[model samples]
Target: MRLIEGTYGIAVLHADFPDRIVVARNGSPVVLGIGEKEMFVASDIAALVAHTRQIVTLDDGEMATLKADDFRTYTTEGTRTTAEPTTVEWEAASYDMGGHDTYMHKEIHEQAEAVDRVLRGRIDDRFSTVHLGGLNLDAREARRIRRVKILGCGTSYHAGMIGAQMIEELARIPADAEPASEFRYRNAVVDPDTLYIAVSQSGETYDVLAAVQELKRKGARVLGVVNVVGSAIAREADGGIYVHAGPEVCVVSTKCFTNTTVAFALLALHLGRTRDLSVRDGRRIIEGLRRLPGQIAEIMEQEEEIKKLALEYAEARSMLFIGRVRGYPVAREASLKLKEVSYIHAEAYPASELKHGPLALIEPALPTVAIVPDDDLLEKNRAAMEEIKARSGRIVAVAHREQEKADHTVVVPKNEDELDPILLGIPLQLLAYHTALALGRDIDKPRNLAKSVTVE
Candidate 1:
């Protein structure tokens, strides 16, 4: 043990140890699953979920010795410790693909239901706001929050971008998101009145976990926006909102990303109500939130059409995704999903930025996917589409209505402008799925990527 350093989750057993096993974690995750007269230890709770739904998650610098019917938790100094077992809400079946061909496909189909779970019992129709009991912040404390900063990595980092925008727009607070790895290493200024949020699907992501720990040590208020309960980030943050994305088994995320966006919407609503957001606008946003599940279903009904579109675009050597404002993040996420699932080279840029440099890349062989919502930016995006058209670039438009300038159109349902990103991003999930299917790429297990990046 003296020779060990850095992050590790180790379990050892030997002939001399009989039925007992020793387990410890420094930087990785370890969950102790409790069963009938037996205990199971694993890096993730999913491994022992079928046997038991009760788990005790170990903290950093914690070690445990487990037997058939008993276990003890202790610190590195050898003092005994205790942690209460918490019930895992996710069923064992949730981790399975059910009858789907792959975990990715199953997760894409689960978005509507997953979103509903994150929103259940949180909507306040009477007051036109949201109830987030986990925040542990009263109205006064919430009002004192002057700025917001979000930290995450990869997909979670992209989600944080959207969350930052939402907080800035709705809550009237200046907000932004940065890569967790960079945030922790850059010696960022931590303010007492500024609120920080750490986002991670697994909650065990080492970079994000380290960022949360650093923020807390600096006496800064940090909240965790994570899916997994009892995950390291969840335990370390001062308070947070659970994304409630059930069990996501696919390496390429689908449902969890959607659920995290929905969770952010609720968080934004809560913050907005505490500030200057009027009750009328609050009710309007709440109504729009209620319509999201049905709107998602509407997008799913277009799978066959999107599959055909994917086949049409699959032969392209590369692709570009373009959007503006709220639509920009949608384009960024779509670009990522395609590259992750289809093994296709794709790039996303702000629609306005094309003229700056990306316009040179547009050609007949290079296709483009444009997100054109029916908002204030509609005219500007149309102008961008015209630029792509003039360059002879084939355009696949994901818009609220058909675009005459584009070669193909995938029309999505219209929602409130603030909520547009959530609905606009849904069709692209299917597009990426079908594109991968057309190319015979692995949908569930994409090469060189894991579901959760536990290590740096």
Candidate 2:
């Protein structure tokens, strides 16, 4: 296991010696759990928490030997390592369905509470700022940050895109997001003045972890925005925000995605406060953050309506999702959720780009989902919907007001424009769930996709 060249985790059961089990990991995670008269090993802690919270995490180059009553940890180089077991705080029932039919459905509803958990004890009302205790960077280091580069993959990448926009708008920093999968292969430039942030739901994503290592080796400062306490990326990064979304058993992300965006909002708020952001404006954002939990629950109230829309769209051959600016990332994530859970073909495009290419696909048979936040982009989005309606395409808009041109509308409660993306996303989760249900697809475990991509 020590000489393994790539990301791998293996467990071997000796046929002759049934009592002994050997497990090793290179780039992947391995957790050994201790229980009364039993032992367990899994790639994720969520699986082990149900039986035993006392567990030991194996590092990249570590291997372990397990027995019914005891376990031993060591390096593959024939050196012994101390295997200390620590008790995780989560309960066994965290993984349960809690009366929901599927984990996706449960997580969708959990967003309100999950978001509140992420916001708890983090806001500074007196200073009108956000206080992230885990972020090791102080005001001095933060003031030196000239740019922001957020790296992640899939859904995490989308969240980073939103974070970048917030930082650029609020803190006046040059910010952008890059897919971590391609970051290492391209030999990315590491700028000392640029604050690098790695985002991950599992904190065990292999691509993000590798990118962090490469950045550190080049003498760049990096932080992490991650879930799962003590996971690989969480352990490796200099400092970051712990998005407390709790146990998400669903393969498709819902609560974590929302929590991560809120986490970014906090980071952006903190950075902004250190710079030119005023106390008044910071209080506005802070108030907006407080309103999210109630607003999310309000959106969840529309589940039956969204389910109807899902059933209608589920019969389509394909779907188109569109938004402008901040809403663009929302469109992309919504498209991803729909495709992932419902197995439907979906494409997201910036509203401005429709006339350039995607406009050709508009027709009556195809449905369009538009994110039309009532911000500065309202008129532009309305114009795009007019364009789609001109082509006889049926439209469903997620917006603050009912769209005149849209055949159907998913009305969302408005917040600060920077915070609109958080609320606009909740209904789409329900859409994906009911659509998958209508199609009889497996909602929790989508085929060919793992909850965490540990292997590159």
What candidate 2 gets wrong by more than 4 Å, as runs, is: 15-20, 36-38
Model 2 per-residue lDDT tens digits across residues 268-362: 99999999999999999999999999999999888889989988888998999999999999999999999998889999999999999889999
Clashing pairs in 1: none
Global lDDT of model 2:
0.92
TM-score of each: 0.99, 0.97
Residue by residue across 8-102, what tens digits does model 1's lDDT show? Answer: 99999989878999999988898899889999999998798899999999999999999999989998878899889999998888877789999
Q: Each candidate's root-mean-square deviation in Å?
A: 0.9, 1.5
Q: Which parts of model 1 are misplaced by more than 4 Å?
A: none
